[model samples]
Target chain A: MAVYHADALVIRSREYGESDRVLTLFSREMGKIQAVAKGVRKPKSRQRAGAQLFTYGDFLIHKGKSLDTVSQCSPKESFSYLWSDLDRSLAASAMAELLDISTISGQPNAELFTLTLTCLFLLEQYETSLLLSAYALRLMVILGYRPHLGDCVECGERLQGERLFFSSEAGGTLCGRCRESYSGRMVRAGSIAFMRQLIQADLSKLDRLRWAAWMREEVLETLRHYLEHKFERPLKSWRLGNTISDGLERHIRSLNGKEGKEFE
Target chain B: MDFLNYPQPLADLISSLARLPGIGPKTAGRLAFYLLQQPQISQDLAQAILTANHSLKKCSICSNFTDQDPCALCQNPQRDSTELCVVEHPRDVVSLEKTKEFKGRYHVLHGVLSPMEGIGPEQLTINLLLKRLKGVQEVVMALNPTVEGEATALYLARLLKPLGIKVTRIAHGLPVGGDLEYADEVTIARALEGRRQL
Candidate 1:
């Protein structure tokens, strides 16, 4: 088996044997590959920490016919902060899920790889809900799913200062006149501006961008609809996030003696 | 009637054995042949599997597979109900029980929040756990120290903390009887960061 090196992100990991792990990695060179980290589940295993999810590292792997084996791995950026908080951890998991589903195996996409790393790094520093929306929106741009932010998809009319409708089916924003013929969801104008700024600006500077509750809901709603329309199924992690957050919300309301608030 | 021209019944036995965890096709065939050589042992094995399947049921309170309702751990009045330890699997509950260090009841989640596997809070026993936390003062999260474990612990903490209950995670660092030199940098750092002045 020939030994090779790759700078990779640990996208997913699960227990294999009594003391080993199977990792799905997205590397700069290899798009996505499943490799075994032998004995990494052992407490004394040196590669245990590096084999964790969202860990970015330089890995020395032995190429095998069926599945590659990780011989040596040292962390360059563990992205520990992602796991330090609940929201960030969920956001990172969602990001990993998206990356796993969107990319093809063994087909290098440098822009997508960089986008994942940047989003994971930024997830640690920004509001998780806002940052998650931004990451999803920007990811769509990289994968050639960039929505029409400029003109209405139907009549190609300029969509400014008017109530805009975003149709996942129509593939972009629709003008008031064009929306009559289509069934796109109404998107807040502020959310459109925020998304435009988010996709256009440097991710590191996104902290300075103003994010509102309405923006979070609208962005997530539109992006999720577009993703489902494009990908044919809703992202599983996104569904998991909504479930947990909804449970948390209900739990909080019950604790506050405000059961059945009836607020959507 | 495959398997190098084996009989149909023998091939079916091998195929069934191959479906078990950790058993490959070759090992399954070997095991099937071995069982054929030891008829009494094979009968005993079959009886055992049937017995286990017929008797075992998940304890409604803790969700651990047990022969009895409210399993031994849940029925034990000696265990403190006020201090509950939540774990990911029933096997985890067994491991913690072996330690004999915990004196609290357990809530087995059966799984963690693994989105890739389609496991969410609803899939786990999270709702049951939340409902069971009444009069509970503290919840000790004893999930494994993986990304999913961290997320579940934090998620539970977020939900539990708001109910005026103290949420704590089992500290993960160097293992017992482990040398500091052999421990990884991350483990050592986590250990030191979580150190208490004793």
Candidate 2:
């Protein structure tokens, strides 16, 4: 067996037997590789921290007949801050979930690996949940599951202004007359523009974008629809995000009431 | 033919390693050979694994991985103790903290209340959370805006309303950085209805 080294992101892991674990990793050079860490559950395993979920690390693996073994691991980025808060953690999970579903095992897609790692890092930095939605949407586009956001798919006419419809079946923007031909939901002009921008914009500029309340919901719903259509399963992490949002609002209102008492 | 020269233990190790999360068969073979080549590396790997296994524990308060029973957030006096945000997992707390919008304690449910999966209130940390609500003025249900999330939020709302706590949900509408042209009408209307004075 040949020994090889690569930088990998731990997407997920499953227990194997009593003292071993199977890690699903996305590597920079090799794309996605599933490897085993032998006796990782034992006391004093060297690769424990490096093999943790959501950890980015430099890994040394040994080639086996069927799988690779993780021999050595060194942490590069842990994104430790994400564990402190619930919302950030859920967003990160959503990002990881996307990476897990979009990429296939043993298929080396360097672009997707880099994209997933970068998104995970950015997710740690971004405060709003919108960033998570944007990252997921952008990932789908990168993976060739992108929806149509341009001119009407049926008539081939340019979409005028903000009034446009999105046909999930048609896979792009639809003009008024073209929209009548389909049964998908209508998309606001602003949302269409935003979807276009998300597809075109650089990751660095994501922070500068100003998302309105209505636009955020639209983007989320549209993306959710696209994902459901593509993956055929609703993202579990999205549901988790909504729960956290609900908890946050209630907490804030109670605080407000306390402040109100002080004012009185 | 090579079985006579190769030790059964080494081959067994390779097979075991190959079965792990991301280890392919080739990589697993490499690892087993490496172990034979460098015995010291194996020792180091063994030790690191033992440390994490023995030392790490989840915080009793938030269900986050911590050495202490109650995490720093739960014990911190500077945080807004009166407000508690209940989330599905420890990661949700991290996302909200990045926003710098919230300043309160948290309760990590470890998992969501999924009826289809047989994950109900008993499966979560709901009781531990309710016990912490003594002085908390409000409890925010910051779950994902999905079906299960909505169901969990609604369930909590009904449970908490009688407690006289002002239960509110985060505004669901357009995102702060999203474009308006692509939004759907239902989302737009919901956002408009949930709009605040500010």
Candidate 3:
């Protein structure tokens, strides 16, 4: 069995047998790989910490006939905050799910590797809706499925005005005229403008952008439909994240009950 | 006339057993030989499997595997109706029931939100949960501490809370009676952060 080392991001992990884990990793050197971490479920196991999902690490793996075995691993970037916060964890899970669905085995793409790491880093730092929207858009861009933001996807005409439609089947924006032929969800001008900014802007500089709650809801709904159409499967992480936020909002409201609000 | 050199029925038995989780071909082969020595045991096992497969039905309210429509727990009037405990699997219902702590009804998700494996909200028993939340006041999310579990809990919470019902998760942290030295840093940190007034 050939042994090799790679900088890997664990996209998915599930328990196997009594004390083992089956891990799906997206590596910089090797695109996506499924490896087994033996005894990782045991408390004293060295590979336990490193085998966790979203833990970017330096992994030394043994290439077995069927699946690679994780021989040794040391964490480079655990992205621990994602696990600490419910919202961040959901966002990270969504991004990881996208990566798992989009990529195939053994095809290395540095763009995707960097994008995954960057998105996780950004998600940990910020809880803004722009962070997730940008990550999803940028990921699609890296995968060469970049949604056409500026012009009408059906016609070559430059899009104008407030009313816009996004077509996942058509792969981008559609004008009022083109919207008739293509089926898509209607999105407001602010969503389109924000999407345009997201496409043009760096994720690091996203903090500077003034984010509105309505814009966040619009963009998220738009992207959710877009992703579902393209992927042919609903993104679990998106639903999970939305649910976490909704639950949080409700929790805050209950804490500040009607009686408490009257006092304030 | 043996194909690939195994006894006729033994090969079939090994192949069947091999398909089960955690069973390798070698273990399956061994199990087949072991079963052959105990013919009565094999007959009983086959009968049990067939009977369970034919008889088991999903409980209408809880979605747990039951011989009855609403299951015993859901049918029981004594179960606390106001506070519902949401769990990922029916086995989780079993585990939680052992604690005898929660007196509420249960909604088994059947599985968590796992998109990688093509599992989503629609795939789970979530809509049933939503429909059942009409009269419920609080939902206790008793999902496992895994990423998928946490995601599922949050997703259900999001859905349940909007109905003006309170949603709470089972506190995640160190295990009861677990040593702090053995506990992972993340678990320890969460424990400290969620520490309540003693």
Give the alpha carbon lDDT tens digit for every residue of A1-78 in model 2: 399997998876666766687888888888788899887654345565566567788899999998799988877877
Cα interface RMSD of each candidate: 4.2, 15.6, 6.7
- Weakest ten-residue segment in model 3 chain A by summed lDDT: A255-264
Best by DockQ: 1
Model 2 chain A worst lDDT window (10 residues):
A255-264
- Which numbered prediction scores highest in TM-score against the true structure? 1
TM-scores of the models, in the order given: 0.91, 0.57, 0.73
lDDT of 3 by residue, B50-130 (tens): 999999999989899999897999999998899899888788899999999999999998888764565666678866775
Q: Which of the two candidates, 2 or 3, achieves a greater TM-score against the reference?
A: 3
Candidate 1: tens digits of C-alpha lDDT, residues A1-264 = 399888999999987856888999999997898899999978788899889988999899999998899999988888877666877787788888888888888998898899888888778778887778778888889898888886887788887874578889888898877777667787878788777887888888888888777778888888888887888877888777887788778777675664223221
- After superposition on all CA atoms, how large is the RMSD of candidate 3? 6.1
Positional deviation of B160 in candidate 3, in angstroms? 3.4
Off by over 4 Å in 1: A175-183, A255-264, B1-8
Q: After superposition, how far is residue B53 of candidate 1 from its true place, in Å?
A: 1.6
Report how far residue B188 has shifted in candidate 3, in Å: 2.0
Instruction: Indicate the TM-score of model 3.
Output: 0.73
Best candidate, lDDT? 1
